[model samples]
Target: MNPVLKLTDVTRIHGEAPHEVLALRGISFEAHPGELVAVMGPSGSGKSTLLTIAGGLDRPTAGSVTVEGTDLAGLGQHGRARMRRTSIGYVFQGFNLIPALTAAENVALPRELDGVAPRRARAEARKALEEVGIADLADRFPDDMSGGQQQRVAIARAVVGERRLILADEPTGALDTETGEGILQLLRARCDAGAAGVLVTHEARHAAWADRVVFLRDGVVVDETGADRVDVLTGPGAR
Candidate 1:
């Protein structure tokens, strides 16, 4: 089967002329269905750049990004936006929920925008919230929930439909250790159930939830390790 997400020789450059900063350098990667890969790197190492490119939120400066065998470069802006709503799910450090909308409505918004009937979209949203262990909070607005609950709502929104690839960038940045672990568990479960997941985090313990870990340094992939051995590659003592 084709990989859920693939990046071939991708690069991203910001700025112009003498001040240009290379955000990524010929990075190549693939995340298959049922696999969760963690991307580890310090600031400016291209972790967030890679996620944005994969999710079609940003264009690559070179090479291509394929989602389930469909080359994103071939899609026009509208097409790419539709693809993002239907196939890619992104979770950011901040919960980007609409403050006035309840959790279920927030989760249902994307589906609704995609032309899914409001009734069905809301039903799917409820299921997603339940999957993330927050069904009881479905009727609550983001302001009414705790930080963890809000993040759970964010997760529900991301994975609400048949979204095949989930991209999380520092998703746990605001949560406490236990809440962060809960979020990781939800991501892991989603991957196990067939969606491909890429989690970008600097914490070794957070990366521990992934099946494989890809380490980046100065915008280049410096190491790749199986979950069992990620410590040797990312641990402070490792190099």
Candidate 2:
């Protein structure tokens, strides 16, 4: 099957000359439709950098990033921004919801930003909320909801537009175990529903939800293991 996202020898660096730090070093990967891949690494290992570059939020100093066959390096800032708005969805560690907006309103924000009518955008948001099992909390603001519920709302917002590629960075970091599992299940469902996803996480259990888990160190992919082959690490060590 064709990949929804692809990265080829991608590299990112900060500073220059002797003081430069490489955030990513010739990384390459692919995510096909109906697949969920996990990027596992310790802090400062370039997992987040890879996600941002793949999503077009950050430019790689070398190599290429493509989404659904479109070369990201070829696009200007405005073009990349448009691609992010219309083709990719992002979920961050923090549930970045507007404090004053209700769950429905938060989910509809992206569509609204894209110039869709509020009424239609809201209807779509409702559907997304329902998909994430949070429709009943549509009227609740972020402060009024539990951490799990807030994260669900964030997931609903991320997937509301049916984006081809979903990039999640430490998506369950703030939730408890049970709640984290629910969030992982939601992401799994997205893959089952035909959206490819790249999940950046430190927890092995969370990475187990993905079909494959890749380990990175010092800005390079150093290891890869299938979920089924990771049973030993998925127990208490996963925490």
Candidate 3:
């Protein structure tokens, strides 16, 4: 299958030479459409750095990242930003929702920013919310929902458009195990619908939901394992 996302010998460094610390070193990987891959590591393992570079939020110091076959290195800042806004969906651990906006409104923010009509954006947002099983809460504000519900809204918002790639950073970190599992199921459902996803997480249980888990240490990929035997607490079959 053709890859939807690929990272080739990618590296990111901080500070200057001598004092420079490498966040990522010669990292390479790929995710095909309908696949869910996990990035696992301890703190400071460079998982976040890789995700940011892949999403175009940060530029790599070296190597190349291509999404949907287009090399990100070739795009200027503005072009990359536009591509990110349109082709990729990002879900952060913090559930970055607008406090004042209702669920539907929050989901509509991206389309609105892209100059989509308010009515049509709301319709699309409703569909996304429905997909995540949060349609009933469409009029509720973020503060009015539980953490799980809020995260679902965030997920809905992330997938509401024509986005094909989802980059999730510790997506379920804030929720309890049960809630986190629900979130993972939602992501799986999205993948079943043809979107590819890369999740950065420290929780082995969370990583289990991925088809493959790439483990990172220091600034490099040290190991990768298939998650077929992984249960929710350790492997991919976790409820």
Candidate 4:
């Protein structure tokens, strides 16, 4: 199967030369439809950098990012925004929901921005919220909910419209263990249903939900292996 997301020799630098930091170095990566790749790394290891670049929220200083066959660099800002709304789903570490909108409205916003009718967007939002087991919280605003509920809303927003690529950064960080596992299961199911997923996580148990696990350190991939070998590679209970 073709890759839904691809990064070729990607590099990202922050700040000017004298004070700059390299967040990624010539990293090449790909995630195909029906695959969920977990990126495991310590702090400042570029796991989040790779995610932002892949989601088009940030551009690489050098090299390329392609999603569903479209070159992100070639799309320019508005084009990339369009692609993000229609084809890519991103779940940020911080719940980035608009405080004023309720869970359902926040989830529906993306589809509406993509030109879907308001009613249709609302319908899709309902389904997405239900999928995340938050249907009853549909009318609740972010500030009114618990952290776990808010995180569930974030997940619902990301998966709302049959998006082809899903990018999640520490998605379950705020949830309880059972809820976190449920969130992981939702992501696994989404990948199984033919979407490509990239999860940035540090937990081996969480990595077990992935089809493949990639280890990164100092802005470089140190190793990669199948999910079954994560405990061996990361060391049992390591992370």
| Best by the lDDT measure | 1
Candidates 1 and 4 compared: the better one by lDDT is 1
Question: What residue pairs clash in candidate 4, if any at all?
Answer: none
Best by TM-score: 1
Clashes of each: 0, 0, 5, 0
lDDT of each: 0.91, 0.89, 0.87, 0.89
lDDT (10s digit) by residue, model 2, range 166-218? 99999999999999999999999999999999999999989999998988888
CA shift at 216, candidate 2, in angstroms?
0.5
Identify the runs in model 1 with alpha carbons over 4 angstroms from their true place. Answer: 227-239
Give a tens-digit lDDT track for model 3, residues 1-239.
77788887788899998999999887877777888989999999999998999899998998888999999989898779777877889999999999999999999998988889999999999999998998899999999999999999999988888699999999999999999999999888888789999999999989999888888887777767884433212222121
Q: TM-scores of the models, in the given order?
A: 0.94, 0.93, 0.92, 0.92
What's the lDDT for residue 40 in model 4? Answer: 96
Q: How far does residue 25 in candidate 1 sit from its true spot (Å)?
A: 0.6
Question: Residue 80: error of model 3 in Å?
Answer: 1.7
